[model samples]
Target: MSEPLLLEARGVGKSFPGVRALQDMHIELRRGEVLALVGENGAGKSTLMKLLSGIYTPDEGEFFLDGEPLRATGPRHALELGISIIHQEFNLMPDLTVAQNIFIGREPRTGRVFLGERALEAKAAELIDRLHLPLDPKERVGELTVAKQQMVEIAKALSYEPRVLIMDEPTAALNDAEVRVLHDLIRRFRTPDTGVIYISHRMDELKAITDRITVIRDGRYVDTLDTEGTTMPEVISRMVGREIAAGLGPEGVREDREVVLSVRGLTTKDLLRDVSFELREGEILGFAGLMGAGRTEVARALVGADPVESGTVELRGQPVRITTPAEAAKHRIGYLSEDRKHLGLLLEQDVNANIGLSSIRERFQQWGFVRDRAMRARSREIVDTLRIRTPSVDQTAKFLSGGNQQKVVIGKWLVKDCDILIFDEPTRGIDVGAKEEIYRLLNELAAQGKSIIMISSELPEVLRMSHRVVVMSEGRVTGQLDAAEATQESVMHLATLRPETEAVS
Candidate 1:
């Protein structure tokens, strides 16, 4: 007969204060298969993963592993029972080395008295080598890039050698190449005795790697579909309970608009070199490139977060020297960083505090005193405008989903009324439905005469949202194309254009 299911959850229900996080949720994972779980942000995806990982005890229902009832008291217990989870947000200790972070609690020891640093590092090195990861075991985690840190998280989860693996938005920080490596590793991990539950909002990836797609909506199970038999549009419709239009891109060119900001010969000490571009009023300018192509560095340099070696920035034909983010703010330029958790949002604060933060001194302060009532009123208005899924403005920022947290950051800049906005990977870890909302919001802002510079690694996003696309390669502007001229093939060609080829051209 057929083999038993690898993992299953039945009638699962969970509730929190003022939130019915999940109710009547169910899923089944067959042996040797990759099952993709998809839904909009705050649709009980992470909540279910937490329940499976022993981070939370379900108020009702049961979980079965290998046809046996499975109950875990805590995360450690769950790991001991052959279940491991990699959360979306990182849990690495920044001060520690890679090896230490990977095997923190379980370290080799000499007779249980002294820690074996070399042995620990050697073990980590072997794992990294086996996974084809470019990482140094002795390197400090805080010194590593966000992409590398994500790799470390994957390594840590795999170190447990669990029978069932659950990964939540595992590729949010990864590029195309890194994603390939991760997919290969996942393939190697899958066996007849093991199964995987892959949770992500990247529909393309779900098609590439998963065997079955299970959709959940509003904290409840929707339907499962065979990957080969389903279309992405159908899956999305099931996810959001409606039909969404396809091929949504820039409406038209903005060539006739006035140039509001111009950069010439932009260079940084590390990577950026001779980057130049112009952003028009009420235009959406896109920055596109491969990983390490210095796209993020351009945004950082423009905002004065990174020191620029040589460059000239002009606002409406007048040159301006901005040496700090405060100066950029003075010029009404707001930068929303890609690393939103660490750089964009104040996780410890509430939604109101985060939304009102950038405008406090100018809009919510009087006579050296903070105005709480006015701030709350304005924060509520932004909350409604952005449709941030928070119970109240007083809810902690950390408690919101990744998409809502991103919206909170956007709301911060909107409250400041910045005329020039830079969004760096604005939809990095957000779901499809939320991405649509963010896209709509961006178009709305541009129509309101706010200039936007959108830096994204996703080529489709750049092609869809940009009025003019600027392609960068090895820290230099390789080419600029209007919406009509920018295609996947054309953009990729310029993205791979090297300095030698650029000089030749």
Candidate 2:
């Protein structure tokens, strides 16, 4: 009655130093079905993805494709065999055009020497048309927004036209409207002759996109459920092997005090325009907006990560000029960038070094020399506090999971005793369990009188975390709402405010 399995991994196992990444894992992707791979961060979902994509070979187990033995070769070979993967991180080259990035290796050529630019754009245009995307094929990848970059990634993968397509957190950077387009495309792409592996941590997308759900915990096979029949609580319980608390974070409400950070008429060369808001002591002030709505730009300009043409940053009513991130940090303002991998940590360095980065001079160093003992002690304390999963303080930062890496960034700020902190998409690429931990940490920090400005794309997250919400649209603060007034509907309305009318609710 049902289509036969297109691919299966039997008793697959993989391991890395000091970590049993995966063991005794079984997975199946059936043609005509979207298989959802659900797991917590560090649950070996990534490991399993790598194996299926041919980036990594399983130490144990076998893969069968259409009942034929499939030896794990490599990515190119995998694509040749009708298997393709879109990594969680963007794999696009910034300097190249969208068309060039998509058709890099297989570009149309002129006389076997020059790349046929027109032909390349035409082919990319065909793919873009099919997806109903408004993006220009010849536009440089670096110039596009995060959401557009995500679309380019999908376009590139779909170009391969594989029978088995794998997507890891494809909707992580996309907005609600863009996500709808992606879901529609995925539904259309999944035919009886094709199979799809949908790996994501977004709970709302699980049943909406997938037919069957497979749960993996701690690198082991847990259980599988029909997507329509399973509930969120059931899926989560299986992922963590226990009951997780119901709410996003623990209940620790802080009473608002005097304004800690006040901004007036903040303007940037790109995106942000005349933005003004105030963050109070012991408050979690959330910045909510759609893609390219200037939320991140405001956060960056506040911490001097970007130049502000005209703006006033008043810290505790004291007018301060923040011309650089270092100056901001010196003034007790810490910024956690949304692009954590590229901007947050020194990937080649150890976890301890990153944790002690902000206060290296005063706290972890002395007399123009390094203080290894102090650094190690402080790193251990923060790692323990943040629950960073690593073999030791010396573990490389790049090897840590996305959530752990986020914790390290948080640790950097915490070590500096920063009072004004800005967290931009703090939980992006993070699993649900780790997300709750970050929320708990944020709530705890607020309770401890830390003023926070949190920028998030998810409306539910905005409502769940913030005592007050600031909505931005077209580089302007459209509205501000207290916790009691900031419903999803109200936030959406403000986020989509038009330029002609200024609506501050």
Candidate 3:
């Protein structure tokens, strides 16, 4: 006989003003199995997770645990009742140590009043060691790398020892090695009485770690399939309600094209060294490397978000001095950051306000007054063009899904009419359908004579979207390859080449 259902949601529905976020959503998680839940952005995936985690109560329907009706009052209550959720956006306290963040409210104490730092760290250390995660319990979360911070989040979730664990885009920021470690942990977490609900946009990972797949679209349940019996394209088709076209390879740029941006010997005090590259007009330049390979650093240093100790930047054969982001913007350059929540979008603001931020003074100000009407009109146009799923332009950005939030960031830069655009991990947490849309948009922008620098960790994304690829390693440019020459093997070979090793070769 099959294992009993560990968790089940029956006809669950939720709604907010101006948005029917979810309706008649159903999911089942069997004991000792990892269940994959997938849908396009704004397809009610997040809403369902929130309801299951007790962040939101369903307006209708009910949930059950072990065949018992379950009703949780809040997140804490859910945790107490054997449910823990790790959200895509972190809930960590930057200034606190990993140990403190892991056991914030339930820390061991002396005399029931004084905090016991040593005991807390010891507990965290034991948990980390148990999970085989490479993390220092005493290290400040703010000082850790993004991948390490992700590990801390995992540690915190697993510390709850809940019967049901919900992880949202847990591997979005992780590298291959880190991802392997996570998969191992998930395998170890599986037990006869516990189960996992793994939400992700990555199909390959779903195949590797999940037993069954559940597809939801537009806030409703579609179907569920055994992972091994179904294909990715089939799953995607159901998720988007259409057949997505096959991947399109990048077309090479002409050598005669004008060079729009030139960086020669770009060096930063921290991690970049003598990085040199030229971006041609109407070209999509891809930067690819492993974690800490300085791809992001290059983008940051180029846009003056980070100081360059030694380097020269030239625009159209004319040298330019850019020491701040405002100066970069003045030069008609825009950067879409990888950390959208922290760096790209103003979450508290509405969609219209966030989309018009970059071009506010130029396009929305008249006689020292803000032109709110014109701003909303422009935002509406971009929203429709980008197919951003929101109730209206007046909707708060924080209410939108991760992919839609990313689109808003893109719209802000588009409204600015920047000649040169830098997109860092533009589809980091976005679904496959949204990724295809962004790819098409990038190609269209390049066809419109705009130069783009795309930094991505996904090799397939880089190979598919870049006219030329720049490989980085150990804070230096290891190799540059044209579209025809860039392959996964070639890029990985260059990305792993250390400066000293390259020099010796």
TM-score of each: 0.60, 0.61, 0.61
lDDT of 3 by residue, 176-253 (tens): 788899999999999998999999866677888999999998899999999999987677667656532233457688
| lDDT score, candidate 2, position 186 | 94
In candidate 3, which residue ranges exceed 4 Å CA deviation? 1-4, 109-115, 244-314, 317-321, 329-505
Q: Candidate 1 local accuracy as lDDT?
A: 0.88
lDDT per residue (tens digit) for residues 211-327 in model 2: 999999889999989999988767766765753223432233344578888899999986677888888888899998766678888878887889999979899999999889999
Query: lDDT per prediction?
Result: 0.88, 0.85, 0.88
TM-score, candidate number 1: 0.60
Off by over 4 Å in 2: 1-4, 109-115, 126-136, 244-321, 329-505
Model 2: weakest 10-residue lDDT segment is 243-252
lDDT score of model 2?
0.85
What lDDT would candidate 3 get against the real structure? 0.88
